[model samples]
Target chain A: MRKITAALLITGLVSAGFAAKEEKKENLFEKKLMQDIKVLNEKIENLYKLHVKECAPEYIAKAEAYLDAIDGMSYINPDTGQIERTEISPMDKIIFENKARKYLAIAKEKVYSDADGDGIPCYQEIEQGTNPFEAEKKVSRAETEMKEQKVSEKPEVKKVGYQPLKMHARIHFDFDKYNIKKDYLPYLNVITRYLKAHDNLKIKIVGYTDSIGSKEYNDRLARKRAEAIKKYLIDHGISPDRIEIIGKGKEDYLFDNNTPLNRFTNRRAEFFVMEPTESQ
Target chain B: MRLLTAVIFSIFLTAGSYAETTTTELLDEAQNSIKAAFESGCPTYAPYEYYKAETYYRIAREETSKLNTKAGDAAAIKAIEWALKAMAKRYGEE
Candidate 1:
């Protein structure tokens, strides 16, 4: 009887050991399955959020379906008789995600089509009430072309000109002399042609001098320079009443008068073209 | 031995977190680049290149959100490259 009791006790201990081992295996499987589900849930949520941000309702629905499929399926490992993962394998999940990506790409292409190869999308063009089939000119370009066409379509006036041609002619002088050099006659000739072409325009001849001379002396020199230019214009057939003369003695220097070259630049005669006022 | 195992586990966790942070940084940079290109009239001057850059930027954002760091990094790099190309085209550069 004592031997029988000992054998039974040994059998009970062995059975308990096996049960403990099985329980540990089952816990490991359950832990792995839970971890996988958590990861999958996060991925599904991420996909849903992405579609929402993209404004893709169909993709949102697909993400929901994937989540439902995962939740409804089991992950039992047949060999171990334990739950190890979800029904969807890693490869299958990748394929499913790739399908979503492909759908998104196709949707984007359809929505953002630029049929005319314009930088603007077709949907944007339609929103702007423009033809999507053809490239539309930018607002600034359209405005400029319209303005040019309007100007071109206006009738040409005969006597009363609305716009005046403004021009400037310069004649450089010798260091201190007020005499007009022959070298500047070509420039004056161009101005003469312009004045003749536009008879309604008036010319103002202004003279300037370098800073070397006294203000009074330079002023007289500048006056003489203007007078010489006026004499040349009168000799060239321009009306004296159409010209006005002024002398600005070293007042407005074109450059700093520290160097001889800069002083030479300051000693120049300038012509101003005045436009007629509306009252005139 | 337990302390050694704990240190190694913590190091691995830190590395994994660092990878995630890197992906987020890459995505942010790609977004900034794409925004700059668009603001410079790249969409108007270089439509095709701008579109390509935008597509890559979108993919990068999506992959980063999905925690697919490897794919996200590649897409982010592509996004910046295409964005630079768009900018070059907009400025009339080859």
Candidate 2:
């Protein structure tokens, strides 16, 4: 009975010793994992500090989460009592780094790639409804300045009511001659001054005749008188295109051609200033 | 107590009068500046600056109409600033 009791005590002691040894081995593995986690945390903190300016806050937080996942991940080999790193894979690390790189690339683009060189980023220019590639097309300070000068240089010309100048001097001609008389020269000078001042004026010269000859002969004489006036105006620097001549030839007489005075009044050339059309 | 109430009412009336005067002055100055800028070709040349000035001036007018004197004064000052900026741009200054 004593020997059996001694054997039981020995077995109990051996069992306790084995349990303690196992606990020690487990503690060592846990200690190693804690150390690895600390190291990983430090590395993550360093990376975050280094790229805080370039990387966005969200990406940094995601990176930290990935580091945590890596740190918490471990697999135990039952046969060899070994811990395997199975938390974050190499591909996961690569993905995190790539994401960080993408953020950095975006930061670089914002800092350096100003397509218009208008002191505004391309993304901001797009938001402002301005051209990103063409610097001049955008509403830049320099372009605004140039536009200001152009606006000041050209004053707007307003169109008031159109009032055409009328030549009050009636052009009288000799009874038998188509030549313009000396008295009409002053009227022609006035017309020339007005035409020179306003290059836009157009004129109509109408010639009339008294009832003294055949209708055909009167028509020819009236035409010659109108042509004489037109030739005078063209010779005095007025454009030929601006003048239109017509011969009434004893039709629509202003005065009765019965007496010499009435005949003189009837046989005359009238100058009418034409108003500029609205389209002109 | 009645005397105190009358005094407080008078004070309120005076303050309201002062605020109205200040807002009116600010709005007048703003309008004058905007008119000058427009006449200087700000609308055609410095369109963006002119737009900003006009927007601020409109806001100032609206606020003044609503009797929001403080906001109206602030908006009027901003209007003047933008109008001057438009004029500067019109004169070929950056």
Candidate 3:
């Protein structure tokens, strides 16, 4: 009987050890992470409604990849093991959440940026209510056809809407990035329209950077910034032949690198307009 | 003389082939395992488990530096377990 009791006791102890080993750890950030993910999902959906996918496809793609990473996360019902919960460490959750928010902001900016410098946003033009895009133009097909045909020939210069003296404009860019900000897009729109109206005027866009990064990197970044403006103008209707892009890098600075505003002043794309010999 | 011989014999039997593992060895093993799990993309796919593994490994190193062999061994063992869990999570098994 003593031997049987010893055997039973040993079996009980071994089973208890196995039970302890099988218990799963609880995920601590289940509640907060779930809330954050829900909010991010709603923000992404709102951006989709604004048609961000068409304007800023890269940002949308990154946002989608981050959202996909949430799959296979932990926090399944610790009691019943029924439903899987959104489960990641607080640091990782913050990383993913902040990335999603950043991308969403970029996408939203692209959707709402004013393409023609009109007070109305691009989304307002795209939305089905009024469609001010074609309706507000009011130009006859004959005039548009004439304009298209004139592109290959010597074109008659139209009076530019903005003041001619405003030709020397500088647009500031975000730190270490080439994406044009929404505030600058309206000014760039004015430049695009001016270029379209005056094909004989060749404008050189000089890019500059702050004294922060390495020389080589700053030169490349400056070139990219100029190229970004060139691409925007070309996309809007400017002839590629009438525009020149140059990267001046960090050679010219408006202020010493002592403050944030000083650095911002240095990170700019400056325009210099020149008339052809015949126009002069 | 016989009692001394028996005592030594018993001590030899008890200590036979039982080389005690040091905290250094446990921590080194855990570090390698954690690195392997990270290379398997545990930080992206099994973020929580990987975080736990990294945290336990840090605690193990701190305890070992302080000469707290018992706590160091415990934390190193936990780090190894969490690393395995992270790898298992990557395979959709954990």
- Candidate number achieving the greatest DockQ relative to the actual structure: 1
Give the per-residue lDDT of model 1 (tens digit) for B1-94.
Answer: 9999999999999888765336677778889988999999876656556666776566556656666655556666667777898788677452
Estimate every model's Cα lDDT from 0 to 1: 0.64, 0.62, 0.67
Taking the tens digit of each residue's C-alpha lDDT, what string does model 2 give over A178-209?
A: 89887568778899888789787778788888
Question: TM per model?
Answer: 0.31, 0.31, 0.33
DockQ scores for all predicted structures: 0.03, 0.01, 0.02
Question: In order, what fnat does every candidate score?
Answer: 0.00, 0.00, 0.00
Fnat measured on candidate 2: 0.00
| Candidate 1 chain B: 10-residue stretch with minimal lDDT | B68-77
Model 2 lDDT at residue A68 = 34
The Cα error of candidate 2 at residue B12, in Å, is 99
Single out the weakest 10-residue window by summed lDDT for candidate 2 chain A.
A155-164
Clashes of each: 0, 0, 0
Candidate 3 at A56: error in angstroms?
A: 32
**Candidate that would win on TM-score:** 3
| Displacement of the residue A69 alpha carbon in candidate 2, Å | 99
Lowest summed lDDT across 10 adjacent residues in model 3 chain B is found at B62-71
Q: Model 1 TM-score? A: 0.31
Taking all chains together, the TM-score of candidate 2 against the true structure is 0.31
Deviation from native of the Cα of residue A184 in model 3, angstroms: 0.6
| Model 1 chain A: ten consecutive residues of lowest lDDT | A49-58
